[model samples]
Target: MSVTGKYGGPLPKGPWAERLHEIFDRLLAAFGPQHWWPGETPFEVCVGAILTQNTNWANVSRAIKNLKEAGLLNPEALFSIPRHVLAEIIRPAGYYNVKSERILTFVAFLMQEFSGDLDAAFSLGLWDLRSRLLSLKGIGPETADSILLYAGGYPIFVVDAYTARILERHGLVGDDVSYDSIQSLFMDNLPSDPALFNEFHALLVALGKGHCRKGRPRCETCPLAGIHLNP
Candidate 1:
């Protein structure tokens, strides 16, 4: 899987999408769709995506619990809370100061753009919503896709470290691949369905965690090993 430079080379075609689908199907057969972004509300999903940045889900869960306990889980309440208080409450998520400010920034945008209505705020057409989200201060491609696919029911594929690592291991995408390119690869090949996107991303995370790791990739026992015979 060693390549010359990063990204911008030929893409993995042929049975590429089929192989990816096969891996996803096997994982789903084993682990189910995961139905991720577990939250009682869309606002909670969006908040979780923001807080989950650069941290694991366990810490994000703790931070969400903190907000729920403080009754600051809603948009209005979160917006009204003092910055320091919010930061203190989300301290378990790490980088609390910055994440708190980022949350406030999003809440403020929601208030101004959609009158504190998350549904309305997220009601824009898919591309428009993604563009608007990307324009936000702390929202990058992954966060934007998370909010779009999980929270707003868009079909865009969300690329994470796990997806990148899996693709790199299979020589699908290079290390320096641009976010848009990797994202487009999946979106272009797969049918545009939120459920599929959701399950696909989760399966990639599962595979990355279980096999395609950072240093020592478990290629021998990897689920995708047999699928990528030519690679």
Candidate 2:
């Protein structure tokens, strides 16, 4: 809605695009396309977003298979299933009890507010949708952005540990920058392009996993070595 700093100036195009491209090129050269946010449908994307909290894709995949085997991956089915049953099913994903409640809460919100129509839910303006999602329990900044970026195809930059580390090290932002501030740095500077947000976030995640780790960063092999912020 507010297209001020989020979309005003010249977004990352031309030489800026080249910088992004170089980042992507080196990442792709090492890891390939990634074909991220792995899911068959948008519903699955939303579900995966919830299931992936504090877990890896492999565990999330197992949990999803559990839901699929139980025939309750859809909104109605997920909502109707007994909470304990759902928790049991998703046990493999870790934090089963809490995540079960989170999934149900989000699905209930969808059912009540949007009649379970995902497109309708997404039709709300970016800020409105994000605000509404933040009101839900367990839907923190990262989770809300993940749903917006992957599920709704909104051009909202998703920030996580990797993004914070990369940006801070690159001197692009302060160490104490809030989640919204860090995300704003990207959304303000980059074009409001869903594809770019999606790919860039995924690339940052890859970089974090491979190089910018917190405890033991591998700066020697890092592509963004010279770009480190050292703040």
Misplaced by over 4 Å in model 2 are 1-30, 228-231
Query: Weakest 10 consecutive residues, lDDT, candidate 1?
Result: 1-10
Query: Where does candidate 2 clash, by residue pair?
Result: 169-228, 169-229, 170-229, 171-229
Model 2, residue 73: what's the lDDT?
79
lDDT of 2 by residue, 10-72 (tens): 556544444544555566566655576888878888888888999998999999998888888
Residue 226: error of model 2 in Å?
3.0
Question: How high a TM-score does candidate 2 get?
Answer: 0.87
Tens-place lDDT per residue, model 1, 1-231, is 111111123334446556555666666765665778788898999999999999988999999999999898888898888889999999999999999998998898888889889889667899998888889899898988998888988878999998887777667778899888988878776666677778779878888888888888887877676666223
Give the candidate number with the greatest TM-score. Answer: 1
List TM-scores for all candidates, in order. Answer: 0.90, 0.87
